[model samples]
Target: MRRFIDSEADFIFVLAANVASIQAEQDAIGFDAPDAKYPHKNAEGLCSFAVLVQEKFSDNPILMKMARIVQAADFKDQLDDHPAARGLQLISGGFPIVTSNDHETAERAGFLYDALYASIKDNVGL
Candidate 1:
């Protein structure tokens, strides 16, 4: 994934597993969704990382719909939040099995996401 980024990129952002270990950098941003102890503003407490990003760039209805599905699928307690969460479960649960690596899996999943967005746009008139 880092290889896919532009060489001239100004900054990088990542969802850190441990935000405390991240060194201060003017060109990078790190976020964490800790489930346990925290100073404040944890992602798991309010919403999934997907929701946080979607809310920021929510001008597109299709992406917003996908984000809702992601939020439901990601949270154990909110698995029923969206009707399509179960299907997302099946797709994501087995996605890594056939793919060769993290980058490959994510790149292949892009097609599925494209189809989903198109389907939503066509069927839901979004």
Candidate 2:
């Protein structure tokens, strides 16, 4: 999990929650990635997309909430202690996150995504 600085919001909480969800899946089943890949390799594009979505749904409280959650959960410390990370460690038997696909375990990835978006929106006052 990547960490973001420059804010003290609840982004860590949201990230932890999402990570937890994903780790659950990995524990139940398994992950298959031949080579290491950057999950958010296109972060710039993703950020741009997030901005567009926020702009389009500026009046939607639900969207706002999601952004705020994400923003608040973006801290580095949170990523280090995230439940998902722990879960992955247990399931993978000590594999590094870069080689793991534990984040796919979330049953409700959509909900988690929504919450993250809301958290980010709230933090940026968008």
Per TM-score, the best of the predicted structures is: 1
How would you encode candidate 2's per-residue C-alpha lDDT over 1-126 as one tens digit per residue?
112212332221224325445545444211121111212212432222234336566776655454333333333333353334333234334333323343433323434454555555676677
Q: How high a TM-score does candidate 1 get? A: 0.64
- Report, for every candidate in turn, its global Cα lDDT versus the true structure: 0.60, 0.37
lDDT of 1 by residue, 15-57 (tens): 4554444424342334333431231245444444454445465
Assess every candidate by TM-score: 0.64, 0.28
